[model samples]
Target chain A: MEIISFMIAPLAATLILGGILVYFGIHVIKREIVFIDIALAQIAALGGTLAIVLWPETINGGGHEEGHHLIEYLFSLLFTTLAAGLFSLLKSKKIRIPLEALIGISYAVATTAMVIILDKGAGSDVHIHDMLTGAILWVGWDKVLRLAGMVLIVALFHWVFRKNMMNLTDNYDNSSYKSKRKNWWDFLFYFTFGLVIVEAVQVGGILTVFAFLIIPASTTLLFFSTWRARILAGLLLTVILTIPALWVSWTWDLPASPVLILFLGIILIISGLVYQIKKKVT
Target chain B: MNTLLFLGPPIVISVLLSIILGYFGNHILSRGIIFIDIAVAQVAALGTMIGLLVGFGEESLGLEMTSYFFTIVVIGIFALTKFADQKVPQEAYIGIIYCLGLGLALLLAERISGGSNFISKTITGNILWTTWKDVWISLLLFSLIGAIHVFFQKRFQSISLNKSENSSINRTRLYDMLFYMTFGIVIVKAVPIGGIFLIFILLIAPAVSVTLFTNNWRKRLIGSWIIGSTGSVTGILLSYSLNISNGPAIVCLLGSLAVILTLWVILRKRTVSV
Candidate 1:
């Protein structure tokens, strides 16, 4: 009972976060901008680190002081919006470099910049470890409720723009170069994406957020084709995987985020194998 | 003068890393596998973690060999998955591999005492503490890798730049395996000295900046070396004066340089159009 009670918050957090992430993941995978989430997550992290640097009071031992989370969130969101603008702008055909290369460079530069900032300002090496590992297991009910509200708003936003969003991702290769409206839609998509990533990274850390975003979607894609089927199945898969992953992590005293990621990776590999075998059998 | 003497080895190592990584960065950019280095570096770090877990001393030859072995396996996986690019983009796989490696490393880090320190050190590196022995070893290893690249220059160029349809699938796979194998080896060696962040910047920023200006392969390579070396030297000096970590300092310098060059290119194009 105690363990179950303790696990409930994290499990709920995962499901809520996982729901939106998997949806975004499908679009991300479809558009083939697979690394964009990680890049944005790093940029958000850079923002959060800069906040800590500017206001050292935010660094109370390892975690931030109470009520300062909003400031940090806003800082990260501001940085992410700027990056979203840059990404949307850079989608020009004149640029010969692949978008993936630019994304990778963004990730590298953001990470290194964070390192420099952390070194100079707070001098907290522990913050780097914290950012990567996250505090999913220690998540409170307040945070979960807060996350739910944000996810709902974003989910509703996506639902309203479903036609534009779906069309953009579905026919990305065909329509992207033709439409000037594509960039506007891209900015909106990325801004919402940044919102989710900033929150997701806060809860699940970068790796878990990535695993939640990519692995479930990739796994579902191996078994399903349609977006409707893929998103529904991916969300279902994440929900199923989260419970066992949390249980295993709790029972064994393992780190929650990585164990969850490893579980996702295992499921993805199994799904790939099953897909291959089904192809052979049919 | 005293500062120069103290920072000499680090400066040399940084320049050396930039030269090789700059060359490989061109290949990476052309191949559209920019995140491959990060994936490879993460896997190598995981291998090192595993080696440590299995009781290999931190600086032991066995640990080094274990790291190399793990890197080779990832290189092989990447080579095999190259064909799957038709079905799924390679970037997805690279991203997956990176996450898996990082997650597993974190899981393992939880087991070791002071493991978080090790993890942070791998990311930030300890370039200031580098000895002359480290410099000589990297020089010898880098030169050996450089010689191999020079020897097989034509095959690599054909595969990476041209992606010629003339080459057989198996032959291309072999060349790719060979390419990533050398690339992985360089990353493994360089990660210890410059850390993953610095190493990534060293690999990318120079090649990216140079490619902004030139089309010729020789010009790109020479330009990359010049840009890389200058960034490295200036970065080291700045870090020394600022009393900051060398790797991030260098990364910031190179990163700014790349950004400046990119903005210049974009603005120049705009002006020309006007």
Candidate 2:
């Protein structure tokens, strides 16, 4: 009972954060701006790394995990948001960049800065370590709540932009919405998108975040057409897998992120095989 | 004078590698092997992690060091993709290889070196203390590979674009000769610096940027190489001045080039319309 209850909070967090990422992935796949999503996600990791090491530890000089959970979660989100906003500014003309390329460069810069940080007395630092790879098992109440909040915000924003989002994806829709108050809304989409991707990193590290954004949403694109179905498929699949993965992580003493990714892969293979079998049967 | 000598080999290597990667990558992008490059590089990255695991953060493991760590995958990729089974759509197979390989890599990394080390090291690695020889070797391979690509540009272009189903070169089918060689070299070249993450950028980003504006394949090819080289030089300079690591700086610098080019294209299209 206690174990199950322990699991519940993070599960809710996963639902919200995972949903935002799934939506973000779906939208970016449409926009052909995934490379930016990719870069920003890494930058957010960089931001998290900087957040941890830049602060002076109390006694251990680094191993302030359980005590500083609140600080860690809050700072990760804040920095990731900042990184997202900075790159999203590529849409501005005065800044000078094609938004896509700007993102690629930003990814490069962020990752590079991260490399610098890591090299300059960083690898030894647990704060730098934890930020890049999320310490999922140790996720406290604060982290869960944070993820849930982001997820809720994403859900609200997604509900508002449903029509515009659909319109933007389809060519016919894009033509009509071209005149229907675009530029700023586009920023909203991309900005909120950055938040989703970055925050997902906090919950799941870079590898898992990429897999989270990509596999389910992309796989759903295989069969489903409607926005609702796609979101449902992505969310449902994510929940289905996240549970086993996390459970398996605790059981086998494996890392949650990799286990989650493997679940995704296994799900993909099974899904593929199912398709194959159905094709044969039909 | 020493600085030029210091910089000479890596820069030349960079230009050469950029040229090769650009030309071949353009061809591959047209042929739709973009993700394959990424997949293979990631696979190699997984291989390197296996190396790290074997060494256990220690440099040597006597005879057991770095051997067969990637044996399963090296053989798998080599056999499946070495131009033998080119008839069917092997793109899916290649993608599968990448996913599976990375999965194994993560598991191994997690088991041996804790999950955090597994994730961070795989994606954002350190090149802060690279040796001069490392730079020179990168220069050598990048140049050789780049020259080969330039020499075969016309052939690559023919195979890439004029996909007339039954071309004389059997462009799609002729992977036996070229793709594997390029594949092997790409892994070899990409391994030293970017880890698993940056190889795709090295392969695709510049080439894709060039594709945005230029319809003419020649210009597209040339532009990709130029942007890539410029990115490399710029990254090196940034690293020098900012005291940043080389790999991320290069990635960042090239990213800037891509953004700049993309912006110009967007604005140009916008202006021309009015």
For all predicted structures, in order, the TM-scores are 0.94, 0.75
Residue pairs in collision within model 2: A98-B263, A101-B259, A102-B259, A105-B255
- Candidate 1, residues B15-111: lDDT per residue as tens digits? 8888899999989888877788888989998999999999999789999999999999988988997886356667778889999999998888888
What is the alpha-carbon lDDT for the whole of candidate 2? 0.62
Candidate 2 runs further than 4 Å off? A32-36, A45-103, A116-121, A124-129, A172-179, B1-9, B28-38, B49-103, B113-155, B167-181, B194-201, B204-213, B268-272
lDDT of 2 by residue, A187-282 (tens): 566667767666666666656666666667667766676778988999889888888778888888886766777888788767766655766798
List model 1 lDDT by residue over A1-282, tens digit each.
999899899999999878898899888888778889888988987887788768777666646565466678778989999999887765555556666666767887888787777666454668778878888999988878878888999999999989889988887767334555787999999999998887777787877888888888888878788888988998888888899999998899888999999999999889888878888899
Clashing pairs in 1: none
Q: Model 2 residue B141 lDDT?
A: 62
The 10-residue segment of model 1 chain B with minimum total lDDT is B83-92
Computed on alpha carbons, the lDDT of every model, listed in order, comes to 0.84, 0.62
Which numbered prediction scores highest in TM-score against the true structure?
Answer: 1
Give per-residue CA lDDT, model 2, range B86-114, as digits (tens).
32234434444555666567678655646
Interface RMSD of each candidate, angstroms, one decimal: 1.7, 6.5
What local lDDT does model 2 show for residue A112? Answer: 60
Angstrom error of the Cα, residue B9, model 2: value is 4.1
